[model samples]
Target: MCTAYSSDCPPASSALHGGPAAPPAAVAAPVVSLREVSVVRRGRCILAVESFEAQSGEFVVVVGPNGAGKSTLLGVMNGFVRPAFFRPAFFRPGSGGPGNGRAEVLGCDMRSFGGWRVRKRVALVAQMVDVDARLPISVLETVMVGGYGRLGLWRRPGKALRELALSHLERTGIAHLAHRPFGQCSGGERQRAAIARALTQEPDILLLDEPTSALDWHAQRGILALVADIHAERRHTARPLTTVMVTHDLNALYHGGEGEARRTVPDRVVCMAEGRVTWSGPVADALDAERLTALYGTPIDIIRHGPRPVVLF
Candidate 1:
């Protein structure tokens, strides 16, 4: 299954070696877990037995080919990837013990938690962060929806909510564009607003789908920086917010590890292939050139650039 993206004509490791063993200290309860999970479409399994875990205040990334079920995996975590006709999504919450609710989230069964309840704990900022251009609301109001769960239905967003949303906008460095229509914002600004809206929910888990999706190099880098900054802030002061960032931008590396074997731990990378977790580990030790090439099915090289790794195929 190898392609033209291999680091050397022969890979350092075989294409199928999944990941390293879980360390002994890796016993802390995962904030989210998926076990032997599966999702079917057209009577065929699109995503099967894919699993990974994220603890409180951790950043996790999901990457795979277009149909590798990456999006489906994210949907399962947040309880969305519903079956069109045959199968159903499954998972456990980070706190639930075995057979209790391993496939749940935010202390509620994804199967039963109402929309508002889910909204309170998880906010999903999809790739398409566009608003109705004709709508007269300012950028500030647009991002305020993040507070809907807290403000509750039918209640007005009082001063506190406004401040929170505004603060997020400012933190995202887009406050000056607050009065602009959400539709008028550039790709990066829109994505930030979407993030701000999600933050308004004060969610414990932030699920971002390709925050850098269609942006250019500069835009993608900006969005990644904003996301990293946001997660760092959430870790420091937010309600133990655990962010699940779904992206294919391999440019953003982490502040973990030393030389060759030095890598990020706990905060691991989950590389998906055909709906399965093909690799998971601290970013540092997760993907060498051979692993990277196999994961992408191309002759890809993991080049050390600046403070991070860049992909060249």
Candidate 2:
């Protein structure tokens, strides 16, 4: 079992050890790939993506306005929302509706394998929910649910699973709150707990939808820092986790106002608007003032502070 903190696992590449490598390795398929994918809800198409790919160990950020289908894109990657494709009547071998498209996550055909199977390898921390204060589950217990996906319904979580959940709670800086009622925790604390739960899954891919939204400035920064540290830590592992985060706050690309470290800058940015990808490119190229201004339909400016660009409205 390759746990999140396993150190005995082999390195991702021999290049890390400066050893003479074998012949050039074959190009691996993308961890997440979607081609001609479209999502419809209530007789309306919410997301239509021609092509989107996230390479292994890459951090990609999806940004756009409120109705740009950013969350829907993440749903497609995590197998929550099935793509709607058109299939000929003759090709429909079953009672299922006609569909046409492809959505592959972690190399599995989501449509064929089912989202439940794909979710076992993918963890999603969706937007914060308003939990009732009287909910009976503790913070730690809530996180333990993540591991239940792998542990079949008949098997109870053993001591090892408990320890694993504790370690993640500690890693996310919410160990002290482990015993607290999940609903009683502050918004930021709840977000941290949510992240801890996702990490407990030991997933190959992490999907975050507005993890830092609806929080105070302090809590927002804390979540961003935690995410950065988690990503950095996973990079040293045998299988670095691929991340896809959706946020409307452009300033989140950098950390700490103006002159602070740009620890949160993702490897790439995918800008979406009107249910379609408006632009996709490296971080530097995607943060252009003109591009963002046009995307948001609002005047925007960018000013460099040290090595990072700060987005100003």
Candidate 3:
């Protein structure tokens, strides 16, 4: 459910997973999990999540109204936000598979001060990153910054980092802008660079915060398609990349961006209102008109013309 400080809240992960008794034998352990999570700031509670879990290769879309703590959820998962009272656990594969259930991240307890190591394995793209118009960094260089966390203090980036960054930029359809000034790029181009930067980390889990926000409709469609392509390509590898994105883009929520009737919806949907989760299930179940209207506190109508359900106000 959402973590908003409001009267209504979405249900927790248990509502969808059914009590969470080791996640069944066939299913692998969730790569990210939070229990009794709570974050407070300035004598005010920001987020409070009872239970949240995301398995490997799962594409989760978190949708909620503004100030619902959607971005904070991703922040906590990617190790950026330190919760006031919570233990966010990560199950990483060790040689064979995700071994014994450990309440640790990157094999170290988050409370143990070595939790910074966990950040190297995760990459986060914030909703907005301000870029000065006069900044001189190239797009490729900007993306290479993602690898710096793994490189550490003394080590300098080499040819390998450049190549990796370029490859990701190409995948994100920004190879042509590799040598261009990062600050001069368009809104869509910048978002592409941000995604490429995240990919350059070779992260186990990718966190995207409103990646399509501020972009035009065409750019939004393009970016969403690019994300889908990245997910599909990674699914064939030994360790598939897991993704969690927060967005208000109805196109993404409905069918992973419009114009692709063949494209599949996200693996799961988590709807939040007032910082509390209201729905957690398949896309079909989460798109009910009444539920969405109540979540946003506005009148919403749904029209099912074909397979896709269009949301109208």
Give each model a TM-score. 0.77, 0.87, 0.82
Q: What is candidate 3's CA lDDT for residue 116? A: 61
Model 3: per-residue Cα lDDT at residue 300 = 85
Candidate lDDT (C-alpha), each: 0.66, 0.81, 0.74
lDDT of 1 at 112: 48
Per-residue alpha-carbon lDDT of candidate 3 for residues 1-313, written as tens digits (9 for 90 to 100): 2111211222133234546565443334567766556667787666766567776668889998998889888766766676545433421134343222223332334443555667777798887667897898999999999999988799999999999999999888889999999999999999999999999998878888999888898888888887777876776466677788899975576644335522465788898765556678987777778988898889988888687777887
Assess candidate 1 and give its lDDT: 0.66
lDDT of 3 at 91: 18
**Regarding TM-score, does 2 or 3 come out ahead?**
2
CA RMSD per model (angstroms): 12.2, 5.9, 10.5
In terms of lDDT, the best-performing candidate is: 2
Error of 2 at 229 (Å): 1.0
- Candidate 1 — which residues are off by over 4 angstroms? 1-28, 82-101, 113-116, 129-132, 236-238, 254-266
Better of 1 and 2 by lDDT: 2
lDDT of 2 by residue, 1-313 (tens): 1113222344446434444775554456677888767788999888877678997778888999989999998888787787765443323366465545677887677666455577888999999989999999999999998899899879999888899999999998889998999999999999999999999999989999998889998899888878866876777577888889999878787662222335445888899998888899987688799999999999999998876688999
The lDDT, on a scale of 0 to 1, for candidate 2 is 0.81
Candidate 1 per-residue C-alpha lDDT over 61-137 given as tens digits, one digit per residue, 9 for 90 to 100: 77666677777866876667632221223343454433322354544444443423455567888877446778788
RMSD of 2: 5.9
Cα deviation of 255, candidate 2, in Å: 2.0
